[model samples]
Target: MAEKASIKCPSCGTEVEKPKKTWPLIGRPARDGSRIKLMIGQFECPRCGRKFKVAVKKERIPPEGR
Candidate 1:
């Protein structure tokens, strides 16, 4: 299940939007060696204009019509 990642601005304390980019989780790799198993997200606060990064857990979605 893909849960919503709560991104809050540290300076203004406002909830930020979802991250635009995601990278593979540190030290953890997918078994396939190509798929992304665990990952983190990078977000920028729109309210304070501050760039921040947070660890986010996301599940991979399978393609439709299996």
Candidate 2:
């Protein structure tokens, strides 16, 4: 199973749902040269009307039932 990602609004402390759109980060080199990638998501707070960007690291994990 995949874990659900969530973020809290800094202005109002309200929990915001995961972003509907996500874009992969490119052209960045890792120190260890790992195959991991970073994803950036933009979201706006419904209550406070504030916009922010959230960075999420992408990784591969085995399924829970395995």
Candidate 3:
């Protein structure tokens, strides 16, 4: 199962949901030999209304019964 991605705000320490819209920033291989893409974007905290950076790690899922 894929894990839900999330990151905390550095200023407010609020658990913010990962941004659905993002641009690729970096690419690297994971320990499991899967290709992982690092995405970056900006988001505003709903509670504090503070803008902050949002980073998300994306990996490809293998076909079922692989």
Per-model TM-score versus the true fold = 0.59, 0.66, 0.54
**Backbone clash tally (model 1):** 0
- Can you write out model 2's per-residue Cα lDDT over 1-66, one digit (the tens) per residue? 987776888789888886656798654445544445568887788889888888755763333342
Question: Model 3 reaches what TM-score against the true structure?
Answer: 0.54
Candidate with top lDDT is 2
Clashes of each: 0, 0, 0
lDDT of 1 by residue, 1-66 (tens): 966767797788889878868787644344644334467778888777888777777455333333
Clashing residue pairs found in predicted model 2: none
Pairs that collide, model 3: none
Worst 10 residues of 1 by lDDT: 26-35
lDDT of 3 by residue, 1-66 (tens): 987766777778787775545787644555665655556777767668777766666556433345
TM-score of 2: 0.66
RMSD to truth, every model: 6.2, 6.5, 5.6
lDDT of 3 at 57: 60
**Order by TM-score, highest first:** 2, 1, 3
Q: Rate the local accuracy (lDDT) of all candidates.
A: 0.69, 0.70, 0.66
